[model samples]
Target chain A: MESILQSLISGIVVGSIYALIALGFVLIYKSTAVINFAQGELLMFGAYLCLTLVVVLQVPFWLAFLGTLIAAALLGFFLERLFLRPMIGEPAISIIMLTIGLASLMQGIIHMTWGSETRVYPAIFPVEPLRFGGMVVSQVYLYSVLFAVVCLILFNLFFRYSSSGIAMRAVANDQQAAQSMGISIKKIFAIAWAIAAVVAGVGGILIGNINGVNASLSSFGLKVFPAVILGGLDSIPGAILGGFIIGLLEALSGMYLDPLFEGGSKEVVPFVILVVVLMIKPYGLFGTEEIEKI
Target chain B: MAVKCGVFKTTYRDDEAIWQTKVSKFWLALLLIALLAFPFVFQGSRYLLYVVNSVFIAVIAAIGLNILTGFTGQISLGHGAFMGVGAYCSGYFMTTLGMPFLVCVVAAGCVTAIVGMIFGIPSLRLKGLYLAIATLAAQVILEFVFVRWRGVTGGSQGMLVPPASIGGLTFNSDFKFYFLALAFTILTVMIAKNIVRTKPGRAFMAIRDRYISAEIIGVPLFQYKLISFGISSFYAGVAGSLWGHYIGIITPEHFNVMISIQYLSMIIIGGLGSIHGTIMGAVFMTLLPEVLRVISGLFSGQYPVLVNIFGAIRESVFGLVIILFLIFEPDGLAARWKTIQNYWKLWPFSY
Candidate 1:
């Protein structure tokens, strides 16, 4: 029971970070209907950029974080304009390939810029563990969960009230309808990508703080698939819930089943869950079901 | 010889003929002669033979991938894993059961087809990216099994495959393996060509163009989709078996997501639905690294830094090439080849 509780807490902490990154996926997919296979690369680039700024340029940590967000947003907007714009009306497979190509491109650039070695981020948070009854949580994990919740709430309010957010949502709902209402689909696409990049940048910083930044950090993008698929690809709140669920699932399975298999069960669990979810609930828990027309 | 201005088909059989004209048949014979002559012509150059042999294997695998993704419009990311299944099966059969090389190759293909169809079950309910992700699950799961199933797969260290042998002759060198790879490449390409031009091939195109209408026209969606998967995986299996025998070893790392993506890029860059294009794509992708190597080698003597980041440069160049091709020539190299042929055919009296 005690071990289970400990696993659950760590799972939530990891899940919140997953949710934050998954949010980036939901954003682009919602507006453009294109799954950005390069989301993980974008996250990795953000972390590396922030690291370079703080460590090499001697910038303050807070300023480097802000700089990373701005740089990431610009990078997103630029990528959308250059690579994605020409592919607006192409086939789904082509778009998918394009994003994959983008992923390879970004990965190559990252490899060239920062050799393939892992680098630790400068400590930004307090190193103490917070106690709650029988359980203890690291301060960084608490900060990650807090940041995730704050971002989620802020995004929720933005979509609920802000004009730009509503416009973006409108475009996602119906491109023709939104166009008729004078909402520029192009602008919405760029904005969606930019915002997604900002979200990914924040997730990257948080994750980098916990685990050192490396090229493999981009794999977190793949992990986000289970979370988004579980929550529903297009649902923001669903991404959060799904993230927490997958995180908890990974933790619990790691604790109880790792010994039985002699290890590597945690990595496979989310994918197993993904397969199960795809087989049983492909549309996901909260995803809108698409209707095909003849 | 007289130059024929144009050729016309009078019946369905004439239109359906694989070679529409005598000229095409003559060219086909010429191409066959060239292929048969290649190994002997390059007998002094083992490296060249090795490259061509790998190209042959890649062509077989790419043809399989094209059958599924290009012809049927079903995008699969589990292709590399399916190839791994084929390799491991053949390796196991050859080592444990003492099976003959030909029998093991066929058996491996059949096994991979079954595994592929099993994973393709979700295609009944899923489409597009959803289906792609589902196949991704198959890839991950198969990879996991390849690592964990130590008794058969030999765990992460992989398995040693025996050299391929016929009744009297054993293929132990690149020179000997070249003929074997070439024979299988020709056989698979012929089979694939026939498959695409027949009834099932037409059904695959129909599904790819628009599945809803294809189903409305009485095409069995589930059966045809599974058939596509089966055929594709069978091709991958054959290719993988040949690859294992050629290398004389099998490892899970040989078949990974990167390889799957490479195959996908081949079909995309070559011409998705064209058999001729599939071969071209395979050749282009296989030779790309060698071309890069030659170029880098030329410059490496002048600047040592060229040697250091060669891998990074190759990767970026590959990504750049894909992006450029997608943007500029989405129809691929096959279409471009046709355009050039037409241009020359209509030269001097061009409209």
Candidate 2:
């Protein structure tokens, strides 16, 4: 019982980071209809930037965090303007390939800048774990969960009440309709990308705090694919929900199945679940049904 | 839209010829001669022969990917995993089953084809990026299997493959192996060329262009899609086996998502649905890193830090090249070749 509880607690904590990363994917996919395969790289870059400001340059953690968000936002806007804009009229595969190319480019840049070595983040959160009866949660994990919940609520409020957020939703719904209503679709694209980048930056800071900064952190982007797909590619709530589920699934599998397999099961179980979900519910649990009219 | 040139075809046979013009036939024959004479010409240099052999293997794999993603329009991100299936299967057959070299390679390709078809089943429901993501599952799952199935695969240590021999001729040396690879490369290219001109090839194009419309015209979606997958994986399998034999060892790391991306870039930069493009892309991508190495060597003498930057630059250049092609020349080198050919053919007069 204690082990199960521990796993669940850890899973939720990890899942929160996954949710944040998935939100980066969701925001881009929702507004621009382009899946930013580089979301993980964005997180990685953000972490590196934060590390540079805080560790290398000796800035305050909070100030460095803000700087990271700003830098990430600029990157998102610049990438959309330069690489993605020219690909507006291209085929879906071309656009997808563009994002993939961007991912590779970012990876190369990161590797060169950081020398492919993992760097431990300077301590930000307390080292102590919070105790509740027999359960203990790392301070970093608890803070990460709190950050995710706050982000989710903030995003919800923005989407529901803010004019810009509503405009983004409108563009996602129908580009022509949104344009006709005087909404700048291009501006919306830029804003969506910036927001997504900022979200990814936060996730990166949290993850880098936990796991250290490295080229491998970029793989977290790949891991988030299962989360985004499971929740629904175009749904925000689905991203969060899927992230938690995959996180829990991974933790449980690591605890129970890894010992039996001698390892590797935890890494593969989410993909298995992804395949199964794809087979049974192609659009996912909360995904909008795709209908084509000719 | 037809432009009249000095050359004319008098019969259907002439019109349908793979090399229609006399000049083209001469060039093709000359190229074949050159390939056959290459290893002997560069007898003192094993590295050149080895590089050419690697290019040949990559060409075969690139052509296979083009058939599926470029021709059939079904994007696959799990191509490297399929290659792994071939390499591992062939390795297993050679080491454990003690099968003959030729038999193991063919059997490996067949096994990979079946596995590929199973994965292709998901394509019947998924499309585009969704299908691409689903294929990622295949990549990850197969990678896990390759790592954990230690009893057969030898785990992370990998499995060693003995040099292939036919009758009494052992292809242990780089020069000897070059012939084997070149022969397979020629055969694979010819097969791919023929497939493009056949019924199934046309069906693949029809599906790629418009699946619903193709189905309306009686093209069976599932059958052709699976066939494309099977054929593509078969090529990857054969190429992979050759790679294993060439390296004399096989590991899961050799067939990762990065390799799949490399193959995809080959098709993208080479030109989708163009056989010539596959060859061009494969050779270009295969040689790029080596070229970068030489450049980096020059700069490393000046500043040691430049070495690391150069490495990153090479990778970034790869991404940048693909992006530039997608933006400026989406049709790739094949389209550019056609443009040049047209310019030469229509020379001395503005068409």
Candidate 3:
């Protein structure tokens, strides 16, 4: 029972980070209707940038964090303008390939700049473990969960009350209607990309704190697919829910199934669930179903 | 469609000829002769033979992927895993069952086709990105199995495959393997070219353009989609089996997500839905790294840093190339080839 509780708490901590990364996916997919396969790369790049700032250049942590977000946002905006803008009306496959190519490009750049070796982030959270009712939680896990929750709440308020956020949502709903209402679709796309990058940056920093930064960190973006798909590709709340579910699933599988399989079940379980989910509910838990007209 | 001024077709059979023009036939025959003479011409260079052999294998795999992604418009990201399935199957058959080389390749292809069909069942319900993600699941699952199933797959350490042999003849050297790869390449290419021009091929195109309309028009969506998956995986399996025998070592590492991406890029860069373009994409993709290697090798002596960073540079160049191609020439090299051909055909007289 204690072990199960431990797994559940840790799962939520991991799930929050997944939610943060999945937020980046939902953002671009919402506004631009293009799934950014490069989200993990963006997260990875952001983490590496922050790492370089702190470890290599010795900048203060908060300053470096802010710098990383700004740089990531600019990178996102630039990528959207240069690569995605031209592919606005192309086939779905082309857009998918474009994002995939973007992912490869970022991966190559990261590999070239940092090499493939894993690099540790200096501990920002207190190293002490927090105990509650026979369960031990790391300070970083607690802080990351807090950070994710705050970010989610802030985004929720932004979408509800902010004018730019409203405009972005309008574009996502109907591009033509939004354009007619004088919302710049191009600006929305850029903003979405930038915001997604910032979100990804935060997720990256969190994950990097927990697991360290490496080229493989880009694969975390791939993991977001199952989460985003489960929650519904276009639904933000669904992404969060899916992220939590997948996180819990992974943690539980690691604890229970790993010994049975002799290991590696955790990595494969989310995808197995993804396949099952796709077969049963292709639109996901909260995703809007697309209707086709003949 | 682009017939010469004087030539005219009198029957559907004449129009449906694979070589539509005398000029085309002549060029094909010349190309074949050149291919046959290639190994002899470069007999001294074992490296060149190795590269060409690998290109042939890539062409087969690329053509397989093109059948699914290009011709049928069903996106699959599990192609590398399918290839791995073929390799392991063939390796197991050869080592444990003591099967003949030709039989093992065919058996491997059949097995992969079934596996591919099983995964493709999701296509009945999913479309576009959803389908792509499903294939990604297949990739991860198959890769996991390849690593964990030690009894058959030898686990992550991988399996050793014996050199291919037919009676007294063994393809132990690159020279011997060259002919084997070449024969399979030509056979598979011809089969693919023919497949694209037939009824099923047209059905694939119809589905790709729009599945609802195709279904309304009496095309069986589920059946054809499964057929596409089957044929594509068969080709992948054959290619993988050949690759296993050629390399004499089959490992999970050879078939990774990156390889699947490479195959996708080949079809994209070569031009989707074009058999000739698939070949072009395969050759270009396979040779790009080799070309990069040669260039970097030349500069390595001058700057030692170039040696250390060559891999990184190649990866970046690969990504850059794909991005540039998607942005500038989305239709791919096949369309460009047509334009060039038309330009030359209408030269001097001009438009």
Candidate 4:
């Protein structure tokens, strides 16, 4: 029971990181309706940015963290204004391909700048374990979970109460209506991208704390796809909810299911659930039902 | 439009025809003759034959992607996974069951098609980003299965497929293999062309353009989407087998996610919804990296710095190419080619 609880704790910690990345993904998809395959590369860039600020520049932790967020947000806004803006009114496939291209572009640029090598991220949080009720939890893990909860609360408050957040929501709901209401759709897209980048920056730093920073760090973007699908593509709340669900399921499957079928049954479980969920829910748990004007 | 050419009055029907003008007929025939003589024309060079064989195999996959992202208007980033399905499934049959290579190839297509349908079903319900997310999940999960399912997929090491023999005629040579791939590609392209020109093709376009209106007009959205997936996967699967047996080796690395992206980019750059464009897209995209390598060789004059510099520049520029094309030539090279051809054809009298 203790081991299972410990697994659950670790799972939520990891899931929180996934949620952070998925937040960026959902934000982009909700507002722009583009998958932003570059989301992973952006996360990769965020982690690297933090690594550079802390290690290369020797900036303090808080300052470096804040700097990374600002830098990533700017990158997001730049991408939307430069690449996505021109592709407006074009076939949707063109936009998706643009993002995919942006992913490769960012990956190559990062490779050139960082040389595709794994770098040791400077420690911000303590790496000691804390004991509670016969369960030993790592400090970083607890911090990650707490950070996710805090971000979620802040995000909820921002989206629910803030005027800018409400405008973003309106843009997400109806692009035309939002435009007619004097909300600049283009500005909303840029803001949505900026917010996503900031979320991704935080997630990248946290995950870099948990895992080493490298090109593979971007793969976390790929990993978040399952979470987004499960929680719902357009659902901000679902991004947080689904990330935990997937992370816990993965941890449990890796532990318990691994013992079965010669211990490899767990690796494919996330996708199995994804396929099953897509087969049933389709729109996902928190996604809005698509309505046709026929 | 009416045109008078050598005592023949060519109408719009003639202009729209696949084979209308005598020059077109002659050119097409010459193309066929060249294709038939490709193996011998290569001077029996195994390396050249191998490269061409690989290109032909990739064209098969490009065709599949063209159908999905091109025609059906669904984007799939997990195309490599579908190809892997065909490869590993055929690998299992060939190794364990000792099935004939021919049977295994067809079976691979069937298996991949069903996998495509299964994956594609969600596409009927989701649009754009959500569907892409679903496909990405499929890629990761399928890759994990390939890596973890030791008994079936040979784990991460992957399984090998022996070269195929037909009625005691072995295709162990690269030239023979190239011809085999060419044969299949021609047949596949021919059928695909006809399929796209049919009612089913119209249905896919209608769904792509406007789903709700198409449904109101009695187009079965689910059935057509599933069929598109089935056909696309079938092509990808067969290509996998062609690739597997030609090399006499199959590994998980051979069908990674990047391959899917390569195929997607090919169709995107070639021009979606056009079968002929798929060929251009696949050939160019597949050769894009290789061409960079050659350019690297050209600049290696007394210093090796050019190679690495060119390599880095190539990757960086390659990424920008997508964005540039998306912004400027979203219809792709095929559309540009069409416009050029039309411009010349209608020169001196602007429409």
Best by DockQ: 3
The second chain of candidate 3 has a TM-score of 0.97
Give the DockQ (2 decimals) of all models: 0.71, 0.76, 0.77, 0.52
Displacement of the residue A106 alpha carbon in candidate 1, Å: 0.5
lDDT of 4: 0.83
The DockQ for candidate 2, computed on C-alphas, is 0.76
Candidate 3 residue spans exceeding 4 A from truth: B1-11
Off by over 4 Å in 4: A261-267, B1-16, B36-41, B300-315, B347-351
lDDT per residue (tens digit) for residues B2-97 in model 4: 553232435977765666567668878998899888888885687677767878988899999888878888888788989998988887888889
Docking class of 4: medium
Residue-wise C-alpha lDDT for candidate 3, range A1-294, written one tens digit per residue: 989989988889889989999998999999998978899999998899999999999999999999999999999899999999999988878888888888888888788889889999998889999999778889999989999999999999999999999999999999999999999999999999999999999999988999999988988889998899999999999999999999999999999999989999989999999998998989999999988887
Evaluated against the true structure, the overall lDDT of model 2 is: 0.90
lDDT (tens digit, per residue) of candidate 2 on B9-61: 78999888888787788889999999989999997899888888899999999
**Which run of 10 residues does model 1 chain B get worst, by summed lDDT?**
B342-351
lDDT score, candidate 2, position B302: 80
Clashing pairs counted in every model: 0, 0, 0, 1
